[model samples]
Target chain A: MSLYYVQKFIYNINRDTKLQTGFAANADMILANYDLTDEEACALREADIGLLYVMGVNGQLLMHYAAYRGLAWDDYIQAMKDGLAKYGEVRAGSYVTIDGGAGGAV
Target chain B: MSLVFAGLCSHAPGITARAERAPAELREPFFANFNIMRQQLEAAKPDALIVIAAEHFANFFMDNMPAYAMGAAPYYEGPIEDPDWLKIKRRKIPGNANLSFRLIKTIMQDIDLAYSEEWKCDHGIMVPLHFLTPNYDIDIIPVNINCQTAPFTPLKRAWAFGKALRKACDFVDERIAIVATGGISHWPATPNSGKINEAWDRDFLDKFARNDKTALLAYNDEAVYADAGQGGAEIRTFIALAGAVEGRKINIAFYAPIPIYAVGCTIAMVDLDES
Candidate 1:
C-alpha cells in the first residue's frame, strides 16, 4: 500500500513550500522519490483527490493537498464523492465514505 | 498560583473558513458562546494559556509521532494551512518558553513526552485562539494529544495526562489556564462531512460534564470508530479535559450540531474554585 509514504509525502509537501514549488513544476520528479505503488503514483501525479482518497489518504493530509492544488473546499468534497463512486470505497486508512456519501452530509 | 481558568471548545477550521456557509442561527449562537468563554478567560487574568489540542499533522506526523507533546518556545507561528484557505491569517503567535519548560518538567514526572522548540499551530490551536484569545495578549503553551494516528492514546492514559497537567499547573507559580479542544462526535474532512450524531454527542458530553471518569474512560476505540467515525477518536482531548477537572462539574456554555461546521459544536468551562 505504501500509504505511510504517501501520507508522508503529503505531510512534507504540505509544510515545505520549497518542496511544493518543486512539486508544482515536476510532479514526476517529486513522486519518484517516494516509494509509492503505481496506483499511488498515478493518483498523486494527476492531483486526483478522489483516487488518493480512495487509496486511504487521511483527509487531514488529503484536504490540504487538495487545497494546495487549488481545489476549493466544495471541490474537495466533490472530488471525494467522485472518488467513492469511481473507486467504490476507501481502500485503507481511517476515512471512509459513509453509505457512498449518499446520506448525512450537509 | 494554581489554575485560574479551565475550558474546552471546538477547533474546526470551517468555523472560520466557511463562516458564511453555515446557518446564521447555529453559527452565530455558537460564536456568541465562544465569545462568552473568551470574556470569562480574560477575567481570570491567567499568566499563560495551555492549549491541549488534537493537531492534524500540522507539526508531528506518523513518521515519528509522540503520544503527547508540549511546545517550549519564546514564540510560535501558525495556521499552517494556507491563510487564505483557512481564512485565518498567518502570524507569529506569542509563547512562553520559560513557563512551558517548567510545566513540561513537572508533567514529565508523571508522563513521558516530547517537548519541541518549534511548533506550527494548525486549526487545532489557531481556531480556539481566534475566539478565546483574539488579542493574543496571553502567552500560549501548546500541548498536543495525538488523535489522528492509530494506536492512539489509551483513554486511561489520556485521563492520567490530564491529572498530571492539573498537578503541574498547580505547582507552577503563574496563574495558569488550560483548555482542551476537540469534538465529541462527527466526521471532519471526509465525504461524510457535516454528519452529526446528536445522541452520541449528548451521551458523551454528559459523562464529560459530570467528570465520570469510569464512564468516560470506558470508551473503546473499536466501538468509537463504529459509532463515532474515526474523528470520534479525538475524544482523547475531551477526556483529558474531563480528567483535568476531575471530581468537579463543568458548566457547558453551548452544544449543538452545526452540520456545515462538521461536528457537534461545543463550548464549555470548569468553574474553578479560587480562595
Candidate 2:
C-alpha cells in the first residue's frame, strides 16, 4: 500500500526488539499499529519480497528486511530477480524497472 | 601542497569477511582489484585521510540530516552496527582533530560550506577504511554527505565542496589523502536491490579513469537518479573527490561487480602529483 509504512515496519523491527518479537509472534498484532493496505500487510507477514517489490517498496528499506529474514546475499538478489519475473514491473517505488518492461536493466 | 593522493571506492560491509562465499569467477577479480588499491594507498602513505561517504542515517536520521558534516573528534569510534556480521573489528579509528578543525574552520568561515562537527561515522566510512587502511595507523578526517536522504546536495555542489576541501587542505600542515566512498549502480534495499548495472558502472569508471570530469558532470541529478537508485547518489562522493583533484590523472585500479553484495564496486587512484 505505502512504501513509507513498509520501510517504517522494517526499520523499526530491525532496531526494536519488542517490535521484532511482536512481528515474529503475531504479525497481525504489530501490523495493526500501521495503516497499511491488505497487500502490504500480507507481503510483510509472508516476508514476500517479490510481492513487496510489485507494491513498490524501496530497495534500501527492502534490503534490511531481507537481511532480517536471514537471507544470504545471493539469495536476496535472486529473490529480487524472481520478484520481477513473477510480479512484472516494480508496481511502485524508486526502482520501478527502467528499460521498459524488463525486470532488470539488462 | 598538502594533498598527496585522492580516490574513490565502494563500501560493501560483508564483502571483506565473506567474499569466499561468492562464486570464484566474480570473487577473484574483485579481491585482486581490492588488493591493488590497498597497495596503492600504502605507497602514497599520506599522513591523513579525509573520507567522504553517504550517511545511511547512522549518525543522523531523517529528522536532522545535514547535507555535509565533518567529524573532528580526537578519537573517532566506529563500525557502529553489526561489527561481527561485517567481519570488521570494532575499534576506535584514530582521528586528526587538529586538521579536521582547520578544514572545518576554513570551509565554514571562508567557503561558507554547511557543516556539522558532531557527526559520528557508520559502515560507510569504516568499510572502506577497513580494507584500504587495515593498520589504522594514519589519522582520519570523516566527512559525510546526505546521499540517502531527500533534498540531498546536488552533484555540481558536491564537486564544488571538494574544491573547497582542497583549499582547506592547502591551509593545513598535514599531507592529506582524500577518499570518496560509494556507488556504481545497485539498489540497496528494494526488491530489485541486487540488480547490478555493469554497463553503467563500466561507463562511469571509463570516464573517471580518463579524467573526463566533463562527462562525469554530464550526468545530472535526474539522469543518475533515474538510472541508479537513491543510494546510488553516493557517486556524488566521488564527484567531490574529482573537484578536489581537478586535473589529476585517474587510475582505475579496480572494477568488479559483486552481485552477492549487490554492489558494482570500483577502486580508483587520483594522482595529485601529476600536475
Candidate 3:
C-alpha cells in the first residue's frame, strides 16, 4: 500500500450536512479541534489523502481532481472508495504509512 | 545553437485580460503586474518560447495519462472562450520538431518517463500565451506535466528534466524562452474558497529569488504541499526553470495572491543571456 497525506481538511458546516455531520463529526469526535495547517488543507484539497487508501491512478487522480474542484473531504473519501470498488485494486508499490489523522475510505 | 530563457507564469483570469471585467482593485494589481511582465518579455525577445504548464482534466483523465507531454506540431488552437475578452487570436507557432523529438528521446533515455505528442492547448498554456504573444503567431514549444496525478515527479527530478531540456534546446538553432505556468497556493473550490496562503507563498518566492535549487529540491512533497497548497504541484514548473538557468539569479517580475480564485498569481522572468 502506498501512503498519501492530507495537508488540510475543510468542511462546510451547513451545506455539506453528510460530510460535516458525518466525517467532520467523526474526526472532531475523535481528534477534537485538529488545527490543520495550510499544507494539510492543500493535501485535503488535492485529495492526496485518498492516495493512502487506494491503488493505481484511477482512484488517486480522480479523488485529487474531485478535491481540487472543492469536494468535501468526507464526500471525496467515499467517492474514491466507490470508484476503486468499481475499477479494481490500484497497482501496489512499497507498503507505506502516512502520518496523519484517522480517515475512512471513500 | 539556441539560447533559452525560462521562468513561471501564473495562469489566472487577471493575467488572461479577463480581469478587466473584475473590480477595479483587482484589475489594478493585475494590470500593474502585466506591465512589468511585458517589459520582461521585451527584454528577452525570444524567437520562440517553450511553455511548461498543466492540463486540466480535459486532456488526460483517470482512464489513461502520460506523465509528460510535448507539442511537436507547427500550430495549436486555443479554447473557444470569451472571444472579446481574449487578447490574442489562434495562430501558428514555430515548432522545432527536431528539438522537441530530441528532448523527448533524451528524457526517456535518462529516466523512466512517458509522454505524448497528441494533446491540445489548455488554459494553463493559453493564458500565458495570450500575454507573451498577443497574436499567438510566434512559435512555441509546449510541454505538459501531469500535476493532477499521483506518482508525481519529485521537485529535484523536475529540475533535472529542465536541465535536459536546456541541453536539447542547445542542439537546435533558434532563440527560445521557457515559461513554467502555475501557482504559489490556491484552493480552487468550496465555501472555504478565498483561501490564500500568503505566508507559504512568500517563502517560495524568497527561495526562488535566491536561486536555491538545493533548498528547493530538498523540500519533500509534504513540505511543498504544506507551503504551496493543493495546486502547489505546479511548483515543479518553477523548479524546472531553476534547473534550466542553473544557478542564475531569478528576476522576479510580479507576485499577487488573487483570493477570489484562491490562487497566488505570480510571474517571474529570468535572464538566460548570462549563460
Candidate 4:
C-alpha cells in the first residue's frame, strides 16, 4: 500500500531475532503476515533494494534493510539511484523524486 | 562550573571511514575540520566527556521509548552491529558512572528525564568518540536524546534540558567536555535522501556560529523536519548543547555535504575560558 507492510517487515526483522531467523529460514512465509503487495513481497524476498525504493520505503527503514542484506553502504546508496533510473519515478512516499532529480516531495 | 571544553560533531559513519568511498576532493575538507576539532580537544585536556547524541532504535524501541536518558553503565560495550560496514572498529568505551550518577541526581532537580544503568553505545555516541577521542581513555557520560523516535523532545524543551544539564555538570567537580552530534540537512535511505539543503545548512550553521540561540530555538517543529528530515531532528542534540554554552563565541571548524552517508558533516565548538 504505502510501503507500510514493507517498512514494517524490515523494521520487525531488524529488531526481532526470532523473526530474522524465521525470515532466513522461510522468507515468503515470514513476509506473508504483513499486508504487502506481491511486488513488495518479491522485493523483500530478492533483497531488491531498487524496487523497494520505488515502492516508497522510507530511507531510515531501507538503510537497515540494505544492511540486513549485507549490502555495503555505498552499494545500498547506488541501488536507490539505480532504482530511480530503472523505475522511472518514485511511485509514492514523503520523498518522491521530482523532475527525475534529487529533490523530493517533502 | 568546570566546563573546560565543548563542541558539536557529526556522527555520520562516512566521516570515520571516508577513505573507503569518499573521493579525495570530498574527504579533504571533512578531515581538515576534524583535525581542527581534534586540536581543540587536545588543548582542552578534559578528564571526562559528556556526549549528547541520538539513538537509532538501537537500544530503546516504540514500546519503551524515553524522551531522554543517561547510560550509567561503567562501560558502554559499543554497538552490537556496525551499520558502517566495519568502516569503524568497535571498542568498549569507558563510562563515568560516578559523574553520570551525579548528573542524574542534579539534573533531576530541574527536569524529570530518564537514565539507564545498562545500555550499549551506538554510532551516534561512538562515531564522534572514534574520531575525536580515538584512545577511548577519557571517562564518557553518554546522554541519549531520542531524536529518531517520534513524539520527540521539543526544541524549546531540548534547550531547557541543556540548561538543566549545565546545572548538573556544575554540580560535578571535574573538567568536562560536552559534545553534540548530528545534523545540517540530508536524509538517509530514500531516493532523494542524499540531496543537501545547502541553504538550510549554511543558515543554521551561521546562526550557531554567531551564538544566536534565540533564532535557533525559535524554529518551528514543522520547519525543522521539512528542512532537515526526520533524523536531522537530531539537531535538537545541538540545541541542548547550545543551551549549555549560550552567549559564548562559536567556531564552525568544518562542514561537508557527504552524499555517501546522506548527511552534512558539520563540526563546531564554543571555547570556554575557565580563568
Candidate 5:
C-alpha cells in the first residue's frame, strides 16, 4: 500500500487527549483490519490526528496560521489523504496517515 | 541562451511600488538590487520580459485547473487593489501578443498543455512586474503555473518547461529577461508561524547559485516541504527559471530573511553567455 507522511506538532496529541485517544483507537482498528506496515500504521495515526485537528473547532484558526493559505476544506482533506497514502503509516509519533481516497481511513 | 537573473520573493504585504513603505532597512537594499537588475535588463534590452510565476487561484480554481496558463494579450492588467501596485501615474505597458501567442502555440504543439488569451496578472506576476517595470510600460509575456493545487509540476518537469521557454523566446527573436519569483522558506501564519529555515534557505541559495539543475529537479514536494516550511510551493518558480536558462551562471544580489512574514526575500541575476 502507498503511504504518505503527515508532520505536525507533538503537542497536538497531548493537548487534546480525547481526540487523540479516538484517533489512535481508530488507527489501531484500521491496522488490525487491513494489511499495513509499521510505517503505514504511523502514517495513518498522523493523518487521523491531523484530520482531527483540521476538523476541530479551532481548525480554521490553525489553518489560517498554518502554511495552507486560501486552501479549501475539501482540498486540505484530499492533501492529507494523499500524504497518508504516499508515505504509508507514520512510524514517528510526530506524523500521521490516510488512505489517499474517499471513505476516510477504512 | 544565457540567464539574465534568477531570484526569490515573498508575496505578502502585496506588491507595493512605494519604496518608502518597504521595511526601512530593506528599502535601500531593495532599490539598489533593482538598480543592478535594471541595468542588466537594459543591457539585454529584451523586447519583452517573460515572467514565470505561480497563480494564487487567480484564473484557475477547484473546478477547473490548468497545469499552465500563458497570457496572449496586447496588455494585461494586474490584480486590482486599493493601493494598486501599478499606480495610475505609471504608464501602462503593452504586451507582445503576437510573440506571446506564437510562443504558446509552439509550446502547445510540442507538449500537451492549455493556453489562455484572457487573464489578469495576479500578485505572483505583479510582484516581479512591479520591480522589473515599476511604470508598467514594458511588453510582458506572462506564464502562470498552478503551484497551489496537487499533481503539481514536478521539479524536473518545471525545469524542462523552462528550457522550452528559452526556445519560445528565441523564436520571437527578442532579447528577453526572465524573472522567477516566490520563496526562500517562510510560513505566513501562526500556531507554527513566523518560521524561517535558515539552513535550508542557505542550502537552496547555494545550489541555485551553482545552477544545480539535477539536484533541484530531484526534489519532491515532501522534500521541499521539509526544507522550505509548509508553503514551499514557490520553490517551483526556481525550477522553472533553471529550465529557462538551462546552463547559465547565477549572480545573487540580496538575501534577507523576513521573520514577520516568515519568508526570506532575495534577488538574483542570471547571465547567459551568448558567445
Candidate 6:
C-alpha cells in the first residue's frame, strides 16, 4: 500500500545511523513516525525481506536493510526470489514485472 | 584543457563484499584492469578526480531528487553501507571544494546544476574508489545522476551534462580526472539479482566505444528494463563520459559478463593527452 513511506523509512535509516539505532531501540515509536499501513509496519518490525520485495521496495534500499537484519548475500537474493514466488509479481514500484514479462520484478 | 582523463567502469558492491566467492579467473583480471586504470590515473597526476556516479538512495530520495547533483564539499565520509557489508572502511576522503565551486559555476552557465556540501558515498561510488583511489589520496568531486527514480533525466540531458562538465574542467586550471561509475546491464539487489544481459551490454558498450551519440541516445526505459534490468538505466553515466570525451573512442582495458557481480564488468578510459 504505502510503498513510498516504506521506501522512505528505509531510505532514512540507510542514511542516518542514529535513526537506524533509534529504530532498533524502539521500532514501535519509529513506526508511528511514518504513515504506514499495518502490513507495512509489520513488515518493517519483522524485517520481512520477502514482503518488502513483494511491495516493490527499491532493491538498493532493501538490500542494506537485509544486511542490517543479518541476511547474508546469497540469502538476501533468495529472499527476494521467494517473495516473488509467494506474493506473485511485485504489486507496485519499479520491480513490478514477473521475470522478463515485466522484469522490473525479477 | 584540464580534463586529463575520462572513462567508465562498473561499481557493484559484490566486487569487494563478496570477492572470494567469484571465480578467480574472472575476478583477477577485472581487478587487474582496475589496477591498470589506477596507475594510468596516477600517471595523469590529476589534483582531483570527478566521479560521475549513479547514486543509489544514499543521499537524495524521491521527495527532492535532483536530476543531477554535484559535491562541493572539502571532505566526505562514506561506504555508507555498513563498513563490513561493503568491505570498505568508513573514512574521510579528500575533496576540493574550491575546484568543485569553480567547475559547478562553469557548468551552471549551461546547466541548472545542483550541488551539495554534504554528500554520502554509496556502493556505486565506494566500489570504484576502492579500486581507483585506494589510498584516498586525490581530492574527489562527485556528480550524481538521477538514474534510480522514474521520470529520470533523459539520456540527452545526461550527455549535455557531460559536455558541460568537460567545458567546466577545461575552463579550470587544476588537472582533473573523471570516471563515471555505474552498472551496464544488471538486476542488482533484486529477485533476479545476478541476472545480466551480455548481448545488450556488449551492444551498448560498442555504441559507447564508438561514441555514437545517435545510437547512444536511442535507448528507452522499457527495452532497458526488459533486457538490461532497472540498473541498466545507469548508461547515463557512461553516456555522460562519452559526452565528456567528445567523439574519441575509449580503450576498454577489460570487459566480460561477470554474472556473480551482476554486471558486464568493465574498465575503460580515454587519455586526454592523445585526444
Candidate closest to the true structure, highest lDDT: 1
Looking at model 2, the pairs that clash are A56-A92, A58-B190, A59-B189, A59-B190, A60-B189, A60-B190, A63-B189
Candidate 4 backbone collisions, by pair: A59-B189, A59-B190
What tens-digit string does per-residue lDDT give for candidate 3 at B180-238? Answer: 88776654322223356788888888888888987778777676555554566777888
**Total backbone clashes of candidate 3, pairs 3 or more residues apart or in separate chains:** 12
Q: What is the Å distance of residue B106 in model 2 from its true position?
A: 1.0
TM of chain B vs. native, candidate 1: 0.98
Worst 10-residue lDDT window, candidate 4 chain B: B79-88
| Residue B88 error, candidate 4, Å | 1.2
Report the number of clashing residue pairs per model: 0, 7, 12, 2, 35, 2
TM-score of chain A of each: 0.91, 0.82, 0.30, 0.85, 0.29, 0.86
Candidate 6 residue lDDT tens string, A1-40: 7899999999988888898889889999998999999999
Question: What would the DockQ be for model 5?
Answer: 0.03
Q: After best superposition, candidate 6 residue A8: deviation in angstroms?
A: 0.8
Residue range B1-275, candidate 6, lDDT tens digits: 58888877899888888888778999999999999899989998999999999999888999999998999999987978888888899999899999999999999998899999998998988999998999999999999999998988989999999999999999998988999998898878775667778888889888988899999999998888878888988999999999999879888789988767777799999966563
**C-alpha RMSD of each candidate structure in angstroms:** 1.4, 4.2, 12.1, 3.8, 12.5, 2.0
Instruction: Report the CAPRI category for model 4.
Output: acceptable
TM-score of chain B of each: 0.98, 0.92, 0.86, 0.93, 0.87, 0.98
Q: Could you give the interface RMSD of each candidate, to one decimal?
A: 1.6, 4.7, 12.8, 4.9, 15.9, 4.1
Best candidate according to TM-score: 1
Tens digit per residue, CA lDDT, model 2, B118-224: 54555688878877888899888888887875677777788788889998888887788888898777766543445677888888878777757788788876777
Candidate 1 chain A lDDT trough over 10 residues, lowest sum:
A97-106
lDDT of 1 by residue, A2-36 (tens): 99899999998988778989988998999899999
Off by over 4 Å in 6: A100-106
- Model 2 chain A weakest lDDT span, ten residues long: A97-106
lDDT of 2 by residue, A41-106 (tens): 888888898777667765555665666676765676677778878888777556565543333311
Candidate with better DockQ, 1 vs 3: 1
Interface RMSD of 2: 4.7
Give the runs in model 2 whose Cα sits over 4 Å from its true position: A1-58, A65-71, A74-92, A95-106, B109-120, B229-231
- Report the lDDT tens digits of candidate 5 across residue range B1-275: 33343444445432243334447786667657866776677677666787777765545544577777787878776453222322423234468778777788767755555667666654567666666676676788777777765777777777777777777666665566777777767543212334667778888878888889877776778777665654576787877777776677677788776544345667887756544
Per-candidate DockQ vs. reference: 0.65, 0.23, 0.03, 0.29, 0.03, 0.46
